[model samples]
Structure formats: structure tokens, C-alpha cells
Target chain A: MAEGKFTQETVSMTDAQKKAQRSRNIIIALVLAAFVVLLYFGTQAKLGANILQRPL
Target chain B: MSVEAIETKSDDVLISSAMPGDYYRLMKPRVMYLVIFTAFVGMLLAPANINPLLGFIAILCISIGAGASGSLNMWYDADIDAVMDRTAKRPVPTGAVTPDQALSFGIILSVFSVITLGLMVNWLSAFLLAFTIFFYAVIYTMWLKRSTPQNIVIGGAAGAFPPMIGWAAMTGSVTIESIVLFAIIFLWTPPHFWALALFRLKDYENASVPMLPNVAGERSTRNQILGYAVLLALSGILPAVLGFASIYYGVFSAALGARFLWLSFKVWKNGSENEHYGFEKKLFGFSIFYLFAIFAALGTEAVIMRVIG
Candidate 1:
């Protein structure tokens, strides 16, 4: 059966695969952080200089 | 086949492992390309200047949301997909990805796309994106697709939403101009898909999907295709009529619309078996070019105006 093709071992990562996976995870995290920072600044720019200033 | 049967099959001891690329394929990248292109054009056409970074983020989120819908569709339709030759090799059907995994991936991406767009862009566009995903995945894929002959006609609206979302990204609300963009795509869809249905009638029949050709007779579908083509031609010129686009664009859109209608007429006239001269096949191929060309013309017009002014 097609299901039998995917044994637990097939899904399990080897040591090299595990190391590569960790590296990819780290890269994804860093990229996500950069996106957040970019979005924050972009929103601020669009909102203008007194974006955070409140009405008295 | 029921969802339960598919899930039960997926719950086997040895689930098929998927590569990263297999997961990517689940998102239907080809369809996503059209969505991204339309949305990008809408963003460009908007009156306001969007910050480049936010604009990129908006497009990224929209693409992800589109991908999420594609994944969910694959998950739900795995049973029929397995049966259809065209889809038998898809990730879920081929055992490259389990239905459960695809479901989780789709759900996660859907939530992520909506939340990120809402936080980074305006809420209105985000809401539209969320609704597009739901409409495609639930309304179209789960319900209308199997139940109705007008599935493409109705469900086509989901595909038509991206440009509006892009316009909303800039303006924070939809406008008549954006709706014109929506209408263009909405009208273009039936003829395009019906042409394809003419050629792939057997695939739909095997899947038991109530496609227009399968439910209504072929002759009726052909007549409907011609009818939609005529309407599409009229709607295609709206941007010029509405004054957002120049006369040059209007002329060009009208020319493309004319050719589209001609192709539809050709498809309706000759239902012959000749492979190379087959009108249905030609129409199907031209329909793709028709949509791309129309959108590209609009984007080009926008660019020229920006440059000259």
C-alpha cells in the first residue's frame, strides 16, 4: 500500500538532516524578526511624525 | 469517498513522507502566480503611495493566504483527486503528504496570513483575504463545486477578490475602480473555465463534480461561454469608461475582448475531433493568454502614466 511507503524511519531525520533542519529553523526565525521590524517602521512612517502623540 | 475514509486511510501506520517541495506544490503555485500578479497590479493602480516595505509584506501575506486556500483544497479533495488522472499525482494522492499534514499546514498558513496582514496592512484587505480563503476552501471546494453547475460562475468571485484586496491595501477600503478590476476578472472566469471544461469533460465526470458541461449539456455550456464572453468584453472596457485608464488602454482592452469573443465563437461553432484544429483546445490556451495580457496591459498603462507624469 502507498501508506506503507512512509515508515517511521522515512519520516525520522538522520543526524545530518537534523542539523540542516536546525539551521533552516534559525534562518526562518531571523527572517521573521526582520519582517516584524520592517513592518513596525513602515507603519510608523505611514502614520506620520506625531503617530504616537495623543489629543489633549 | 467521504472525508472520514480519506482520513482513516491517512491514519495508517506508515504515512507517506513529504519533501519540502511537496509541501510547496500543495499551495498550487501556478494559481498563486495569477493572484499575486492581479493583486500587485491593483496595488500599483491605487491612488495613494504605499510604503514599499508594507507593500511587500501585503503581497507576501496575500500569497501565503492564497497558498493556504490551495492546500486546504487539496486536503479536502484528496479522494476525488486520487481518482482523477490529472490530480492523481498530487502530494496527498501520491502519498507524498498526508491529508492531516496538509490540513494542519493549510490552517496554520490561513491564520498566519490573515493575522499578519491585519497587523501590518489595513484590516479591510485582511478581512477580504480571510474571506477569499474561506470562500474558496469552504464555499467553493466543499459545497458549491459538487452541488451546482454554476460553481465556476459563483466561485470565480473568490479568485476575483485579490485585486480588490490589493486596492484596499492602499486605500483602506474598496472603490468603484477596484470593483471594476473585480468585475473584469469575474466576467473573464466563466469563458476561460468553460473552455477548459469542454476539453476536460471526462475528468470532471469521473470525479462526479457537477461542472457546467457535465450538468448542463455541452451545447448549453457553449452558449453560456459565448454569452459570458460578450459580457466580459463589455466589462473589460470599464476602466477606460470610468476614466481610471486612458483611451489607449480602452482600445487595447476592447481589442483583447474582441479576440476573446472570437475565440469563444470559434469554440461554439466547431466541436470537431481534429486535435490541432480543435476550437475548444485553442480557446482554453488563448484564455490564459487573454487574462494575462489584459492585466499586463493595465499594469503597463499605469507604468507609462507614472513615467510621463
Candidate 2:
């Protein structure tokens, strides 16, 4: 993460980077699950053409 | 991806060595995650379902617009970003991406995303997309950020627009439901960022960015953090009380929200700012989870409602 001194978020080899990375991974997993869960809604019978219809 | 890589490499060098990471960095992926997640919730809660393909397209456009905003922000803030520890190594300031290139790239993608949404969803969503870009890059970054201490507090409306944008993409109209989502995030921003500002206080001071820590004493900032935290905590309960959410959503939101308040409480009472342990910093870290967890819960509730109700 360290880009050097001239930039923001000094990519210092600190413990913080490792932690932030782990947190980021967990977030990615959750978002993926949300995406899968959302997919279930798309397949519901009530969805129908309403899925394609623009709100008028 | 390759093109983005080339854009970051100086035109001064004949053959560019642009990496996908450069584009990722330029997109400000972290902010984009929150933007996309909130927008996803809005789409889920819409009165109608969007076709999965179109839904995907709508999300793509929103994400692209969000990326465009990041690029524009990076383009404009290269100077201040150079000074701040958090943003110094960004593609633009790091000489990885050229400013003019970023500007044009952002504008083009902004247009593309807005147009795509308009064509696939509705003009309302399209218009909102256009507005979000202008608000984030122009209003928040250009006008408010450096000029005021209340920057994130007020400028936060830009970030708050996501769920509304998502709702528009699906329903092509706005409603109290969407607006309430907007208000929740709107109110949530002050405390979220203020907590961040508390720990990164020195960064703002060094950048002369006029964040709350620079303008308000740590005491006043701490008080404000607590105040906003309480507001966020209360707002979390609204989905249930308004009869819009199930007991599950209510209980879960409240629980996560209370933890949020607890963290803010720590920052309020213990963020004396003179100590080295930096508990306020820890609160700031967890606060990201606080927001993400609640929003994720909202998304989960929507899915459950769809499946069972």
C-alpha cells in the first residue's frame, strides 16, 4: 500500500495494511452474497415484465 | 484496463506500462463500494423488479458513473491529495495518470453511464446519474471541500444520493421510501467522516484542508461525533418503526446501530486526542463496518422479503 512519502496513505509496512486488506476481503464476500441474494428477487414470479417496464 | 494503465504512465515515456491496479486506484474502489452497495439496496426496495439483465446494466452504469466521479475527483484533487497521507500516492499525483487524460476519461464515462441508464431504465435514473457526478466532482470536491469545515457534513449529500439513484433505476420514480434512505445516509455521513477526521487529524492539519479537527477543537469535534452518532443510532430504528421493515430488520438494524453508537461513544468519551493508543482511530476503523453491516442487513431484508413475502 505504501506508494512512498510524497503520497497519501503512506504504504508503510504497518500492521494496518494487513488488517485493512482483511476487512476489504470480508466486504467483498458480503457484497457477493448480496448480489446472489438479489438474484433470487430477479427470478421471482411477480417480477414478470415489470422487470423490463420503465416506471411511468 | 490496459488503456488506463497507459494513461497513468507519463506520456513522456514512449511505451506506457499501465497496470490494472492504476485504474482500480483511479476509480477509488472503496468509495465506489459504498456507492454501489447503497444503490443496490435502493434497487431491491423498489416497487417493481428490474429484469436481471437490465438490472445488471443499470448497476454497471451506476458503477461507471461512480468511477467517473472518482476519476474526476482524483484529477482535481491531485494537489491536496499530494499533501495528505491518505491520497498522496493516487494515480494522478503519483504521475501514474495525467490530469487532462483523467478529465476527459471521466467526462466520457459520465456521459456513457448516464446515457446507458436513460436508455435502459428511465430518464429519471439517468438524470440522477448526471446529478450525482456533478455533485461529487463539482459541488463537493470543487466547491465545498477546501473551503469549509462543514465540508463532509454538507457535501455528504453527494454520497447520500446513491440509494436514490438505484431506486430511480428500478422504479424510474422517487418516493418517500427512497428519500428516507437518502436521509439516513445523509445523517450518517457526518459522524462517519468526523470519526475518521478525529484520527487523521494531523493529515487535515498538514494539508490545510480545514476539516473539523483543524477548525474545531478536539473537544468540540468529539462532542459533535457523539451527537451525530446518536442521530445515526436513532435513524437506524426507523425502518421498523415506520412499518416498512420486519421485526428482523428492526432488531438487527438496532443491534448493529447500537454497536455503532457504542463505538462513537468511545470516541466521544475517550478520544481525548492526546493519548497514543488512538482508540478514536480504532472506532473510525470499525465505523466503516458499522455502516456496511447495517446496509448489508437492509439488503438482506429486501432479499428475505422477496423470497418469503
lDDT (Cα, tens digit) per residue for candidate 1, span B123-220: 99999999999999999999998899999899999999999999999899899999999999999889888888878888999999889988888889
Best by TM-score: 1
Query: Candidate 2: which stretches are off by over 4 Å?
Result: A1-56, B1-17, B271-274
Give TM-scores of chain A for all candidates. 0.63, 0.54
How high is the lDDT of residue B66 in model 2? 93
Model 1 C-alpha RMSD vs. true structure (Å) is 5.2
DockQ of each: 0.24, 0.04
Question: What is the lDDT of every predicted structure here?
Answer: 0.86, 0.78
Best by lDDT: 1
- i-RMSD of all predictions: 7.6, 11.7
